[model samples]
Each structure stands twice: as C-alpha cells, then as structure tokens.
Target: MDDGRENLDREQTIDRLEEFQKASVRAIEAHGFELKGERNGVAVFTDKETAKRSRDTFRFIAWDKVSEVADDLIRGATQHEEYTGVVNSSKRTAEYYVRVHRSLGMIQLRVLERQDWEANERTCGHDFTPNPPISSISALKPSGEKRTVGFHVNSRQEKTCIELSLASPTAEFLTNPWSFVSDHPLDGGPRDYSLKVIFDQSMDEAKVAESSLELASRTIFELDIRNGISLIFAPRERVRVSFDAPREVPRIRFPRVKVPREVAALFSFASETLDNPPYVFLSYYQVLEHFLPMAHRRDALKVLRRELRDPFFDENKDVTLIKLMNSIERTKQVSEEDQLKVLLRDFVRVDKITEFFKSADMKHFSNKGPISGVPEVVMHLKSDPLPTQAAKRIYALRNRIVHAKDDPKYDSIPVLLPRSTEANSLKPDVALARLLATEVLINSQD
Candidate 1:
C-alpha cells in the first residue's frame, strides 16, 4: 500500500513538470520570442521578426528552463524570510529580463589591445567615419529589445575599410567565409573591399554568393576602365595597369567611331559576315553595292542623246550616229549600273578614292598604311596609270568570285596579305570592297 502511494506521488510530480513546461512555452510566445530549436540539451528561442530583418540568428534561452529554475527557487523559499524575499525578486527578474546575442553570419569585432601606456595614448577608439552618420535609435520595447543595424567607413592605417556593425543585445561584425583578398594600397588610401553577398531572405546562400561576386566583377571592370587602369586576370596572378592620367588613354576620349545613321544598320551585317562562312563573299559585295551611287541605264542613254544633239556633234553627225546606235544597244542590255567599274568610271574620282583609302586604313589598321600589298594604293589611285588599272583589276576579281562557278581566280587573290597568301588566300577583292564600304559609311556620317 505504501509502494502504491509513492508511485502516485511520482506520477503527480511528472504531471506538474509537464504542466510547467507548457505554461513556460506559452508565456515565451506571449512575450514575442519563438522556440527555434534545441541546442546542447537546452531549448533555444529567438525573435522571429529580428531574425527575418538581419538574416542573422538572435538566440536566447528557452522559457521552459527559466520556469524550472523559478520553480526550484520558490520551493526553497519556505526555509527563511530572507529566502522568501530573494525568491520574489528572482521571480520578477526572470519574468522580465532577456538577453540576446548573434549566433551566426556575423561576429563581434575585438577591441585592439595596447602594449604600453604610450601605445594606449596613440590609439583611438574605432577610427571610422559614418557617412551620413548612424542614428542612435533604440528599438527596445517593454517586452523585448530590438537593435538597429549600422554601416561605417574607416580610413585607418592608410586603408579604407567598410565595417558593418550589427546591433543585437550584444553587437557583432558580419562576415562571409567566401571573401577574396587583393593587393592593398601602399599609401593607405581606399582599398577595394568587396561584399560577396547581401543578406536576402528570398535567395539561397549559394545564389546570393554568386550574384554578389558577379556584380563585384562587373563594377570592378567599369571602375578600372574609368580610372584609366587595365585589370588583367591570369592564372594565379592579377595584373593591374594604371595610367598616370585619364588623358593617357585615348580610347576614353572617343568611345566609338562615328558612322552614318542611314548605313549604320549595314555595318552590323558586314561585321557579322566576318564570322559567317557562306555569306562572307556576299557581305562584301552587298556593302560595295550600297556604297556606290546608283544610276539607271535610261539615264545614261538620255545623257548620250543630249551630247549627240550639241552643235559640235552635228558637224560630226556620222560619227555621232554610229556612237549613239552602239550606246543604245548597250543600254538595252543593262537596267542598272551598280557595278564597281561602271560606278568608278562615272562617279568616283582619284582624290575621292584616296580619301576613301585613308579613312578605311585609319579605321581598319588603326594606322595610316597601305591596305593589302598594293603600294600606295591610295596614292597610285590618285596618280596617273595605276588608278584606273587598279580599280578595274579589283572589280574584275570581284566579278570572278561572285559570278563565276568553281573559278581558280577566286583562289588566286590574297585578301589579308602576309596573313594570307596565294596557296592559302583570303579574297583580296572582298577586303577592298569592305574597305571602300567602310569609307562610304564614314563619309555619309558627316
């Protein structure tokens, strides 16, 4: 009967402990703290709203343990009047006091220690400048405390470092394990400090890291160029080429070579042909066709007729009649005169050809040199004998490549010169056509 009574008391004690645990959990929930998980046999709780905001875990002791401790103190309070007073004070403290600290994603920065009294005098506390100074605002409420985040820039030891101070019950520094280290400025100027990721609740950790690195790389590239520095990345080494002044880099002054708006659309197509195999030849011819001034066969015939009607031609009527008949027959065979030879013969002059060569050379080679192996191709075109011959030969080459099927002449001409030869040739005709086309496009812009 006594054993049965002892078992009954044990069962009652277990039931009361369970009741106390449940009540403690409820009280914690009412106090705006959530039971996160158990750690080291201790029930862990955190502020759910703070966790969401900072992306850092703010941990506290679970209320179940708090209640158990409270129960033990109250049970012992019946021993003495002083004990009773202590129990009441402890109850009040347990009910109100809560402490929180950063568990992960950030850490507390350690204060630098001084070796001697002189070192202490020289050292200052947190040598940092908060741009748009951080407000000393507290989020502490009657139930719980909330801390506001802060950012600052420090220029200590000639280096600019960005520091993030996280405010919890205990302050801590936020850090990432996947950060990269680069060369520091020798003079202690602003050093590159990269944040590989920003705390975002929506993205997973890996994605956040990847996005942050990509953004950092892009920003670095832009900064390097803007500051007249060339950053070259190689295996195991990073090369940075810094210029003394922005003027040293001419490319910045002129970002792009101006081209005519009318023919600007064609330049992309022409550029794309350099990559495409089948359309390569066609691209050159198309550009050339567009570059030339278009003329109708009927227009040529009308001009011929007007010349023949002149008084000087009337004296030579028989010669004029024969010439007119031949011209009429030729005009009947052709509807348009877009052919390079015909266009050059009718419209393009020697000076104009030289100008085209100079413009094309300036753009393509980035230097004023002879295009292809043609010596003074520009000057020769401007001078006496070779001008017309060179033009006709270039046109003839174009015709063989475009019109002829399986022709050897197409393989004979070297387009890229020393880079290409008779045995392994790039079509010279295509090269010349592209060059002239580029010139036309440039001229049309002005």
Candidate 2:
C-alpha cells in the first residue's frame, strides 16, 4: 500500500509540472510573444510586432536549464519589475535581452548581440562592411584588425542603439578586452559588445532621459580604461621627484609611502609631464630638484666661514677670501653634489646608508673590487662610515655627463660617463637617484 501511494504522488508532481509549462506558454503568448514551438526540450519565442515589421524575428529560447527565466518573467509581470535573460551561442558569446514594464500600458525591450570569430563573416550577411567603412580610419587600417563602436538614436521610431563590429584577417580581436572576458568564461562574456538598448514609445520622457544619461556615463567610464589607460611600468619603479610649490603643495595619499602628500604631488607632476610629449630627461630632472634644498648665498657663506675658521682652512686672509668667493660660486652652480649632500646630511653613516640601500634593493654599489670600473671616490665609500663619499662620486659622474667631457677623472681614475645616446646604460645611476630621493622624502617629514 505504501509503494502504490509513492507512485501516485510522483505522477501528481509530473502532471503539475506539465500544467505549469502549458500555463507559462499561454501567458507568454498573451503578452504578444509568439510561441514558435519547442525543439529538444527548448521552447523558442519571438516578439509578434518585431517579427511582423522586420521579418527578422528576435529569437529567445527557454529550456529546463534556464527554467528560472520563465519563473522570473512571471514574477516580473506580477510584481512590476524588470526581467532579463540570455541565450548563449558558445562559451564566449551570447545574445542577451531584457524586458521591463515601464507602466500599466507600456513595456521596454533591449537586446545585445555578441558574435565570436567563428561567426564573424557569416553573422552580418553581405560582405559585412561597417557603415562609413573602416578603411577611413588610418590607425585601424594598419592595425590589421578593426573595431568600431557607434551610438545612434532614432527619434521617429523611439529607439536608442549601440553597434560594435570587430574584424581582423586573423583572430586579434579576441585579445585585449576579449581576453579579459575569456579569463572568466563562466561569467558569460564582455557586456559591451554590440549592445543595443531600446525603450518603448509609451515610456515617460523623463524616465527615458534619465536612463540614457546613466547608459552614457557607464559607457564612457568603461571605454576610458579600455582605450586610454595603460600601465607600462610596475608601481615600484621609483623616480626622483620635486615640486614647484615649496611647502604648500597639496598632498595626496599613495601606498607604502609614509609622506604620501609630497610623493603624490611628485607622481602627479611626473604623470602630467610624461603625458605631454617625450620630455623624460627634463621630467626626471625636475623630480630630482624637489629633494634638493634651495641654496641661499647668506646661509652658504655662514657655513663656509665656519669651516674656514676651523683648523681645516689656512689662516691667511687671501686664502680665506678666495675660499669664501669660491663657496658663493659653487652655491650658484646648482651642482648635483650640493643636492646629494642636503639629502644625505641626516643619514650619512655607513650603517645607515647600507641599511637604506639594502631596504631599497639597490644593486649599484655591490661590485667592490678594483675591476668593477667604479671611481675611487665611490670605492672609498665601501670602507668609510660616511655617505659623503658616495654623494661626491655621484656628483662627479653627473658633472661629466652634463658638461659632455670626453674623459673625466674621479679621484684620478679615468671614468666614463653615460652619453645622451646611451640612455639604456644609465639604469644604475637612475636607480640610485630614485633610492636617494625616496630616502630624502621620507626623512623630510621627521
């Protein structure tokens, strides 16, 4: 008796499922969607008016795999909310559509059609050339691939449209933006391809306007990252930086930097400078200038006078006067050594310099033997406890390069400075400068 009762309950559940399917079909048809019969358990539907007007039926399919679509549509009709569904062609492509009930009397329809490389030539029909032609865009012509995104509005018919076409002799279209989509294959595909949004004629004008504005804003934001921004270098690739504003520059926060405001300003300036043209040298020099203390004649003279009065200088008046004048001249020169001294004054000990260099992961000073080709002044810093020796060597190298000296000597060793043409060879010095600047900026706040 228990076995017979279980069979009866199973039969009743199957009967109820079939009845629900039939009712869903009736409700779909009543809402002006034509039931185009079922194939392999998938039921297809087309809008009656769209089929009549274009003879191009907008096809949507419902199956047991997506039974939630039917349930959601039914719930939307009852609760007055939007319903959306997608029918995928492949793992990476699909056709998506949305139905929104705008009011008691009107409904909105939207469709997005996506095509992959396999269907590229066959999907559009008749040679599939973009309107106005892709040949007219010079940049795209040489790229061997073409992508076009166009927006149109038909006021007479009350429709807003977006069209995207990507074509290539090979399969480069599936690279950039498409690669990002392909990474997460289970999430459908890129949402922007060949999107077409439309609202019914009966929709309120104000509501329509608001929706249009929202769509425009979203499209612009996505395109800005897709086409405009490119991260060419890693975040840790540091550069020496200085600001035009002395102390009142607006600070911005950046990751890892303790004094973010100054660093942020420096990065902003560097970005702006790089965006203009190819003024890399000037831009880097400007950054280096910011860490340097401004040289005032009176302050420099006081320091020089103090030094001369010490046992370090001769007591002769002529020698003293000559030294004072020379100090003034050096201050006017804006030498890189002066900048380095100012930056390293507080942290000149060998241990401190070594610790900072290790933390920054600097490799410029690792080669210590005679065969390393480093100048004597730089080599002496290896055994010395003061950073002054390293600063002097850097300044000497800077002078030789800036003045274009054929053969400059540092502590009597023949040194070769990097020429303008040998920009790639200057990586070591550039890295050192960046590290030094970073140290200076961090200490400035304290």
Candidate 3:
C-alpha cells in the first residue's frame, strides 16, 4: 500500500484520524487501561470510553475512508476481546459477573457476587449457602456495542446498587462522577446505580457557578452485600469551575445606507450593531468618516477646486479664501528685488511652510515664478473646515486621558494656555465637520 498516496487534502483527513487514534491510546494508557488490539487500521483500546470516543471521531472522517477501516476491523475482529457482564443464578447461589472476552482467551471475574439470603427471600435472614438457580452467563455480542444494559442486583427492603458503563468508555470508572461511593459503608450496594447521570457541565447549573465561588461537592455511591451485612459508599468530589469561557461575539454585517435618490451617493456608510445597544447617536461620526476619502483624493481634487463653496463665509469672501487672497497680494506688491528674500524668511519662520519647502529643491523654486508660502499651501488643502486652531491641543489632552495617564484638568482646557485652550465642546464641532466633509465629498465626486 502507498503510504504517501494521500494528497494534501486527503493527508489532512488521515492526519486527523491518526491524531485521534494516538490520543485514544494515550488516554487509555494514562488511565491504566490496556490496549485490546488493532481491527484493520483502527487501534482498539481496552477501555470502553476510548472505543466509544474513537467511534464518534471516526464518523467525522470521509465515508470512503471510514468504510475501509471498518471493513478491516471486521475482518481482524475474530480474536477481539469485548468487555461484557452477566447475571447468573443456581440452586445454591445468585450472582453477577463482569468479564472480558479476548481473541486468545477469556477472563471472567474471580468473585463478583455474594450470597444474600435476604435477597432470595423478602425478609432479613442470614443463609450461609449460595441461593438457588446458579448459572454461568455469557454475552451474545460485544459489550463495546451495547450503550446501556444494566447488570443490576437490588435488595427488596432498602436501596442497593451496582453498575458498569462504557458510555464515556475512555473515562475512568473509579473517578467517573456518576460512580460515587458513600464514606460511611453500609450494607450491600448503593441504593441508586445510575450510569447516565454523569457530570456534564452543560447539565449542572451548580457546577457551572462553582468555579467562581470556589466550591466543591461530592457524590456518594454505595453497594449492599448479603442480608444487610455488607455496605460500601465511595465519595466522588468535584470542584465547580466558575463560569465557562465567554463565547465569541458573532460578526454582524452593517445595513447599507442609501443616499436619497435626489442626492448623489459619494461614500459608503458602515456601522456595527453590538449585542448591547449604544444610547449615543453615532450616525454623525459615521458620516464624517465615510466622507473624507471621497472629498480629498488627488483625482477628485480638480472637481473640488471648482465646487468648493465656502460654507462658513459669504457672498464676497470666505474666511479662508480672503486670507489666501490677502497673503497673495501682500507678496506680489512687495518690490520684486526684495520679495524672494522676505518670502523665504517668512517661509523659514512658519514650521509647516519650512517643511514644505525643504521637501523639494529650493533652487528650482527660486528660478520658478510663483513660490508658495505656508498660508498659500493651506488654501490648497481639501480638508474639512478647521475645527479650531486649538483643536490639536484638545485632542492631545483627550489622548492622555484615554491612555490612563493622569493629567489635571483633562477635560477642561487650562486658562494659562490662551491660544491652545478653548471652551468649544467637541460634540458639535465633530458633527459639523462630518456634514461639511460630506458636502465637500459629494461635490468632489461630481
């Protein structure tokens, strides 16, 4: 057989299968359980839980691969040992036995049942002799396949219990939550022998909350032996784990925002709806964020330069436009011979202007006609209207607060820094900036 025959996709399938098989083996070995045998490619562990878990994982693999292993298991299963239990009775004794069937040989319980005269007759009595109808019992099929068949023996008067399980076949029978014993040993088996009542976190509310409270609980399991004589209780304790790990928040697709048909759509609106509804209005912020890219792109710059009507200023002059014009005229009126030197000096004084000039060759601009100054450059910028000359200072303070840094008057602008400090609440400025940005963006797209 080709070991490397599996392709990448098929290899993943096989690798997963191999991992599951190895895990099964490790678990069984860890719990001191023995390995039964290999049926086809599937390795069978002696623990019933291991076999059951493997069976569950196997169903997840491809049907074709599953069938191949299943067929192999059937062919090689002749000598397979299956764990089984039986209830037997004779003229002298009534008994129950847990046994293992193997391909090589069979191993039966040395002593599983005891004589109980009280069980034979309803009243309390001590009989030394084994009861009537003693018979040896064998499984009709493999115990691995049977989900729930109780090998039960009970008392007439009080509760007596005994049971074995393979449900979580790999799970340890002794440590299993359902397999509890009382500390104070009583006569006979546990009153209730239930295998299905396993400690599943999903089922128990107390266990789920226990982790937070650091609480632990124990269950008592008992088995009663002959005529109220032998009683045993095993205690299984479980500490509650606080709440389970939080589930991941599901991703939500934001609803599309459609612009009015009369108004041209310039940008997309995207918002996330969280599990808890936010009380504040976020539409204004969303609009601003959506509008910036559409308005300021280089390709759309030509269109914006035409439609950039001054929203804040009026008929004769926009505040920004007027400033630009005044600055331009002031430079032009200066004597041609001294204009370059004075302009260069002003450029050096302005931080932004100095950087703009230094970014390119100065000699080229000296030879060229119109040398742009800081104010001139500001005119060309296609950004939202300036919130404030002090906006940057307020933003810096906000940043300090957000990052857990202690700064006095964090929300309040200090009176000392007159130019940097302002009383304008960012809420309204932010809203207007968004609307203005949208206006610029839609017009630019035209």
Candidate 4:
C-alpha cells in the first residue's frame, strides 16, 4: 500500500510540473513573444521591438561582460534611425541623431534624408526615409528624459571620400563602417543606419544636446576656409592627383591635416621655458622631427624675434640675446610694456587673456587700460605695426584655448595657412607641428 501511494504522488508531481511549463509558454505567447529553441533547455525570442528597445533605450545593463561593440553589429542588431525632415520639401538633408545603450556611452550619428526620390514618393528605393526633427527635445517630460534623433549625410562625397575610406576621426563610429560615404546606398539599393533613442531615467547624470539659441553662444566663430577656396576656384580644374603617385604633375592637395597630440603642454612652458626644453620634454622622446627642432634655445628665439618683428624678416638680430631674454621671461611671471613680454605671459598662463594680464604691469601703461575684466580686449597700436597686431592676436588666442573660453572673433582653419610646396614641405603630422610652431613663434616675439 505504501509503494502504490508513493507512485501516485510521483505522478501527481510530474503532472503539476508539466502544467507549470505550459502556463509559462502561454504567458509568453500572450505577451506577443514566443519561446523557441527550448529543446536544450535554452529559449530565444524574436521580438523586433524588444531587441530594438534594448538598443534604443539606455538602462543599467551588465556592460562589463560586453564593453565595446562595433557600429555595424549595433546597427544590424538594432535598426535605429536618426532623422530630420522638412514637411512638404523635396530636397533631402542630414539629421543629427544619438544612439544610447545602457552598456555603452551615447553613439551620435547624423541621419540624412533619402535623395533622388520623387516628391510624392514615400520611400527612397529601399533606403531609410528620414523624417523631421532629428532629436526629441519634448520627449523628456514624463520620464524625466528626452530622446532626440539626428541624421548625417555624405554631402561632400568626393572630397571626403579618401578620408572616409581611411576611417578618419569619429568616422569609424559612423554608418557604412568599412565603406566610404560615396559608396552609400550600398549596392545602389536601400542602406540601413542606426541611431539610438534614450530613456533618460536610468542616467545618474546627463546633459542633453540643446538645439536652442543659447547653445549658439558656445560656438566658435570660423570662416569656412575650405568652402571659400572651393567657391573661389569654382569650375576651375587646378589638377587631379593620386594618393600613391609621386609629385610628377601639378595638383591641388587637401590641406589641414589633424594629427592628435598633447596641446596643453605646448603653451604651459612657453611662459618661461625655451621651446627646446619644452619640445624635447613634450615630445617625450617620441618622433618630433615635424615639430620644433631640438636646436639651441638661443638660435630658436633669435629666429622667433625676427619673425614677430617681421614674419618675413632676415637680419642677424642677435639670436643669442633673444634666447637669453626668452629664458628670463619664462623663469619669472613678470610683465613689461614690451609687446613680446605681454605676449609670453598672456599666452602661457592657461587662462583668459584678460585674466592673465589683470595684475600685470601692462595693466598700468598700455592704452587698453588693464583689461578691466570685460567681455573683450582691445589693444590700441601706438607704433611699430608690422605683425604686432597679428602677434597680439595670437597671444590672446592661446589664452582663450587654455582657459576653455571661446573667442567670438577667432577662426579655426583646417590649415592655419595655405600649404606652400616651395616654402615648407610638410608631411601630414608635420603640418600640425608647423601650426603649433606658428602660435609659439608669434607669442615668443610678442
């Protein structure tokens, strides 16, 4: 009787377990999800929305296990799109969009409109159709967060072609990872891109990108040198050149090569140290053939003084004397009526130009009257104006950069100056060094 009862109890337990499994399946199905791949006790669900939501929404996920992911995989796994569209407009444009993952920081991309489509067409072949307003500024109210989306386009297709092919800065993080922007509409068919939508609740601290006018105040003023030059030479064929080809034919090459380096160290020692010690020190035994040479400090200073007085000057104006003066200026934080002294102090302080000169001796004598803690600085020229104005401007700019303050009148050029094959043949990295040198040379003389 005991054995029979035990068998009955075991059968009842098995039945209950089966019932519970069925109920679990039923519950998942009711939620529009299916339990597949359960034969090995493993289940996989194919919910497009759920997977997409996981990508778009930022939450506390175990990122330590999956720290980094390539943009392509992210796009494929989550088909998020950034877009900005104008209603009733046929012309297409790019939109700025952000992709936020709980595991990864925000990935920002620009979503562009579908070009070559009919005005009445809803889609561009098979490409993603970008709609208006890339970001959702108003979406933040209820959950205390907003989700904005934006799109980017290869507007400068050919010019940016090689750079894109080379995977330039932040370009590797963009759509069509391996392919250039010109190769878009992949295979001449619809191309897919990803953008993220964030649910801000999970963020402990977050600052959203503002699209308002106040945001404009933070921007630096720069004339589009590339665009200007292009306009000036419109319909003119300067020359076509190949990257691998030698300089056999006259050709117009792209300028303003950006090679990343430590900028903070460059201006710091220029206050009192010679470029020799600083360059060697800053270079840290790295390749600096393109930057300042490790020549005698005295010789470098002589060349600098002559150039500041006359950027094109060519007189043996005591290179040794100049070097000695530079060392003294750097060693002490003293300021004098001499423009060169003011320039060194202002350029090296790593503060606002006005703040740097606030307590300096120039505050008492110069026509500008001690900076006054105003929004801007105006230096009146009494005499000797070859490149002095230019020199003063360079000093002020260095100060602005050091302090993280934006100068409304300053300009950011791809290349600080036009490339001249005759004057200075600079490699890509060398060009960056030259630009830094220009800043140092000008400030040293001032």
The alpha-carbon RMSD values of the candidates against the true structure, listed in the order shown, are 28.3, 21.6, 29.3, 24.3
Better of 2 and 4 by lDDT: 2
Instruction: Give one clash count per candidate, in the order shown.
Output: 3, 6, 45, 23
Q: Supply the TM-score for candidate 1.
A: 0.28
Q: Write the per-residue lDDT of candidate 1 for residues 12-68, one digit (tens) a residue.
A: 333544676756655555554555444333344445457445332433333344575
Whole-model lDDT per candidate: 0.37, 0.40, 0.28, 0.27
For 122-170, candidate 4 gives per-residue lDDT tens digits of: 2223233333222332232355443223222221222110000111111
The segments of candidate 3 whose C-alpha lies over 4 angstroms from its true place after superposition are 1-163, 172-203, 207-222, 225-446
lDDT of 2 by residue, 1-446 (tens): 12111122323333545666666656656656655543333344445666346342423333352344444344332210111112111111111122122251111111111112232333332334453323334233455444433323323343333223331211111111211211322232222223233344455544543454344345445433654411111111123323234357667766555554655566455456432221333333445455565323334666777876877576567777787777778777755565566556553345656654555433445444211334433333446534565565455455444454345444444333222122323444444544555556666554
User: Model 1: residues >4 Å from true position, as ranges?
Assistant: 1-266, 276-281, 290-293, 296-306, 312-323, 332-338, 345-349, 355-378, 381-390, 399-431, 438-446
TM-score of each: 0.28, 0.30, 0.16, 0.22
Q: TM-score of predicted model 4?
A: 0.22
